[model samples]
Target chain A: MPDDAAGRPPVPGSDEAFRALADPTRRRILDLLADHGSLTVADLVAQFPGLVASGISKHLMALRAAGLVTAVRRGRHQVYAIDADGLGRALAPWAARYEAYWAEALTRLRAASTGTAGTDPRE
Target chain B: MPDDAAGRPPVPGSDEAFRALADPTRRRILDLLADHGSLTVADLVAQFPGLVASGISKHLMALRAAGLVTAVRRGRHQVYAIDADGLGRALAPWAARYEAYWAEALTRLRAASTGTAGTDPRE
Candidate 1:
């Protein structure tokens, strides 16, 4: 669980985080924010020619709820930026475990595919 | 794209993989298969107290589509097992990138949180 400004429980990094990340569009938004630091909704929407403003807003909301992005009031526009720290932390453990598993599996797969015995090409 | 048994294009490792993994029930199913090697549908369903057979079947379908598990006909019963190699490969790259990002962010965060300068405790 995350804490709010007042240290209260904040709904962040729940299954919603992965669900929000499941979308290609939202993933693109994060990529954009990562590359450009921050952008207004209009600016972010401009990057996707096929997406409507409302649709992008909905995506933004999902990202925000997942703590992947932070929306700030910049004058009249709500600017969004990648909350890199939060997003990175949220994904770390999941990635580390899977990476290790895959690395081992890939090694085994290579050895099996090559028909090599005893050598253990995976090592 | 993955290849079919006949070397045709098989749908595997698509967004469907992540979507299938989104369900906690399905994840638990994978975990069970990993632990038990293989089990019949009835056996797998018995592990879950409240879930219905149909629901578990649906989950099994999703997991199969995602290449997370494989089903084999053992007489009348359909036995399920974790497709460890496929599932492991599918999650590897995604996990690697996110883990690297998180590791860097954690380093920065620790420095900030401890109010230490120059030392770069993250290393």
Candidate 2:
């Protein structure tokens, strides 16, 4: 579960988001969407000419599962667009919470190390 | 690698860092080390009494490999402390680069969507 300050619900799509982010290929797909707006799977496949359509499609499925992108039928093609708001909603909370926690921990650690009543001996 | 802005050497230890952070238990261990100052493995073991010594040890080993924490000899005990500076150096660049990339993408996306020559038709 995300720490309390992340404020988002634990049971929602966060696990999938994390799983999607764990792969570099998925991140690259997000980058492409972010740069080029909506594009069909063919458009994305064009960007990676060496890779077959099936592999790119697999990455797209992972991104969709993570709520990072939205797909809509455009006549014969399925167009995919970055859901920037959704990505922000999913990621910022977790990152912000961790950043805050680390900041607080560092502050406390500094205080303890510097204070006259130093709690732990540094040896 | 690391999208350029995460300037640390790719070969040094990034893959390990990513792998280490992929686990929640390891993150929690880093959290505990952060909250408290340096602690011996025994001290950490005391906190998670339900789990056996070996499990926590495994988590610690992963964190150590990732450079998130440092262990030092203190008499007969091995003390572990959060390597805040190392973590900041490792994570900040990556996060900052992504944040900048996202900011740019959002700006471009907004302009394209709002302009008279709209780049993509929302269908």
Among all candidates shown, the one with the greatest TM-score: 1
Candidate 2 C-alpha lDDT tens digits along A1-123:
324332222325445666676665566676567657788999888776456799889989888878889999989999999876567555553464355434544455456646565323122
What DockQ does candidate 2 have relative to the true complex? 0.06
**Model 1: per-residue lDDT, tens digit, B3-111?**
2122212223536777786665676686567657798889877877667689789999999988888999989999998786777666643443345567775555455
lDDT of 2 by residue, B1-123 (tens): 224332223324445665676665565576677668788889877776456688778888888877788999989999999887667555543454345324444454456556565423122
TM-score of each: 0.67, 0.61
Per DockQ, the best of the predicted structures is 1
Clashing pairs in 1: A95-B95
User: Could you give the CAPRI-style class of model 1?
Assistant: incorrect
lDDT of 1 by residue, A1-123 (tens): 132122212223535677887766676687678778899999987887676799889999999988889999989999999887778767653443334456666555555757553422222
Model 2 per-residue lDDT at B47:
70
User: Residue B35, candidate 1: how far off, in angstroms?
Assistant: 3.4
